[model samples]
Structure formats: C-alpha cells, structure tokens
Target: MQTITWQQFEQTDIRVGTIIEVTDFPEARKPAYKLMIDLGPLGIRKSSAQITSLYTKEELVGKQVLCVTNLGNKQIGKYISEVLVTGFEDGHQNIVLAQPASPVPNGSKLM
Candidate 1:
C-alpha cells in the first residue's frame, strides 16, 4: 500500500461532531439520510449519510461521530452536504460509523 507522511495525515481535518438531526432523503438515488451535525466551534453542518441499513434516526440523534470536516461541499440532488461523516465498511459492505470510544466535545480533532 502507498504510505503517507505524518504531515499529510495531520493535514486531514477529521473532527468529532454530534448528530443533532436526521431526515429521510428520498430524492437521493440510494437510501440515505440528511443529517445536521453540531460541530461546536465549527458550527452545525449538514451532510448526507448512507447508513440507513444499520442506523435509525432515533438512534443517531445525539450520537458523536467522526467527520472529515474539510472535504468541501458535495451536491446531492437538492442537498448540499457540507462535511463528510466517516465510517468503515462492515462484512456486508454496509457502513459502520467511526466514533470515539467515549464522549468527547464536539469539533474535537482526531489526534
């Protein structure tokens, strides 16, 4: 695998945010959710996450998740996703969200 320098890794702005809101996105080609995340100092940002296979809106609310905050906006249908909610692929290729083991303040950078 190709390797990256420490500086390059540090350049990635991965931060923690709390899921404050979730709504169904029927306009999306695939099943997805429109999320409003509270990133503390970074402010609340919107995103589209395809995690419906394993997560429900009720369970996601107030859940702290890791997000790539600097990845610029992504346009999906009428939605403009402002951040990237990060996750790993499960055995079935379903996304499993990445998060801190314990609670941390929102907008906390992954160190």
Candidate 2:
C-alpha cells in the first residue's frame, strides 16, 4: 500500500453528517440512493451512495455518517453529488457505512 504523510492525511476533509433525507435514484446505472445530509456549519449537502444492498430509505434517516466533504462534486446521470459518503465493503461486497461509534456534533472533523 502507498504511504501518506501526516500532512496529507490532515488535508483530507472527513467530517460527520446526519442523513436527513434519502430517495430512490432510478437514473443511476447501479442501484443507489440520493441522500441529503446535514453537515451543520457546512450546511446541507447532497450525495449518491450505493448502499442499497444493506440499507433502506426508512432506516437511513437520522443516521450519522462520515463524509469526505472536500472531494468536490461528482456527476452521476442528472445528479450532482456534493460530498462523498464513505463506507466499507462487507464479505458479500455490500456497502456498510462508516460512522461514529457514538453521536457527535454535526460537521465535526475526523481528527
């Protein structure tokens, strides 16, 4: 694996955000959800997450998730994802969202 400096790690703007809304994204090539996240001081941002294999829209609301907020926008079909909702792949290659072990203030930087 490639190694990175502390500065490089620090430069990554990873933060906590609450999932306020989730909706179906039929236009996406892969099954996914369009999410609206509340990042507190960072304001609300939109993202597209391919976590449908393990998550449902009803279960996603109010969930606090880690987001890479500075990656810039990603264009997927007609959607413009404003942030990157991070996660890990399970044994079945399904996504399991990255999250805090406990609740934290929104927009809190991962240090």
Candidate 3:
C-alpha cells in the first residue's frame, strides 16, 4: 500500500451529510441510486451511489452518511456526481454504509 502523510490525508474533505433525495439511475452501468445530500454549509451535493443492492430508497431518506466532498465532480453518462458517499463491502459483497456512531451536526468534518 502506498503511504500518505497525515497532511496529505487531511487535504481530503470528509464530512457528514444527510441524504435528502434518492432516485433510480437507470443510466449507470451498475445498479445505483442518484442521491441529493444536504451538506449544511456546503449545500446539497449530488452523488451516484452504488448501494442499490443493499439499500432501498425509502431507507436512505434522512440518513446521515459520510462523504468525501472534495473529490470534484465526475460525469457518469448523463449524470454528474458531486460527492462520494462512503461505505464498505459486507461479507456478502453488499455495501454497508459508513456513518457516525452518533449524530453530529450535518457537514461536520471528520477529524
């Protein structure tokens, strides 16, 4: 693994945000959802998250999630992804979302 200094790692803006909207992304090569997250001071940012195999739209609403907000935008077909919703793979290969142990202020930075 490539090692990165703490200063380098600190450059990434990892923050908490609440998922405010979720929609089906039929254009994505993989099964995915288009999300609109409320990042407080950062405003709402859109993301194309591949968590469809594990999460339902109904279950994602108002869910606070960790996001890498400074990755810049990426275009997937016709969709523009603004942030990366953080998660990890489960034993079954399903994505399990990464979230705070308890609720903190929305847009709080991960220190």
Candidate 4:
C-alpha cells in the first residue's frame, strides 16, 4: 500500500451525512438510487449510490452515512451527484455503506 503524510490524509473531506431522500435512478447504466443527503451545516447534497442490491429505499432514509464531499460533482446522465457516498463491497459484491458506530452530528469530519 502507498503511504501518505497526515496532511495528505487530512485533505480528504470525509464527513457524516444522513440519507434524507431516495429515488430510483433508471437513467443510470447500473441499478442505483439518487439520494439526497443532509450533511447538517454542509446542507443537503445529491448522490448516486449503487446499493440497491442490499438496501431498500425505506431502510436508507434517515440512515447516517459517510461521504466524500470534496470529489466535486459527477454527472450521471441528467443527474448531478454532489457527493460520493462511501461504502465497502461485501463478499457478494454488494455495497455495505460506511457509517458511524452510533449517531453522531451530521457533517462531522472523519478523524
């Protein structure tokens, strides 16, 4: 693995956010959902997450998740994703969201 200095790691803006809304994203090449995440002081941001394999929309709402907020916007067809929702791939290749161990304030930086 490549090693990096603390300043390099600190430059990555990963923060906690809550999934406030979710909707089907048929326009995406892969099966995914368009999410509205509430990042507290950062305000709401949009994301496209390919987590339909494991999570239902109802289960995602109000769920706190980790997000990479400095990635800039990615255009998925007509949709503009404002943040990169963080997750890890399961053994089955499904994504399991990266989240806090318990409830923490939204927009809290990962230290």
lDDT of every model, 2 decimals = 0.96, 0.97, 0.95, 0.97
Model 2, range 1-111, lDDT digits (tens) per residue? 999999999989999999999999999999999999999999999999999999999999999999999999989998999999999999898999999999999999999
Clashing pairs in 1: none
What would the C-alpha RMSD of candidate 1 be, to one decimal place? 0.7
Candidate 3 off by > 4 Å: none
Each candidate's clash count? 0, 0, 0, 0
In angstroms, give how far residue 97 of model 4 lies from its true place: 0.2
Q: For candidate 4, what is the TM-score? A: 0.97
TM-score of 1: 0.97
Tens digit per residue, CA lDDT, model 3, 1-111: 999999999999999999999999999999999999999999999998889988999999989999999999999999999999999989887899999999888999999
In candidate 4, what are the lDDT values of residues 77-108, reduced to their tens digit? 99999999999999898999999999999999
Cα error, candidate 4, residue 89 (Å): 0.5
Runs in model 1 lying further than 4 Å from the true structure: none
Q: If scored against the real structure, what TM-score would every candidate get? A: 0.97, 0.98, 0.97, 0.97
Residue 39 C-alpha lDDT in model 2: 99
| Candidate 2 Cα lDDT to native | 0.97
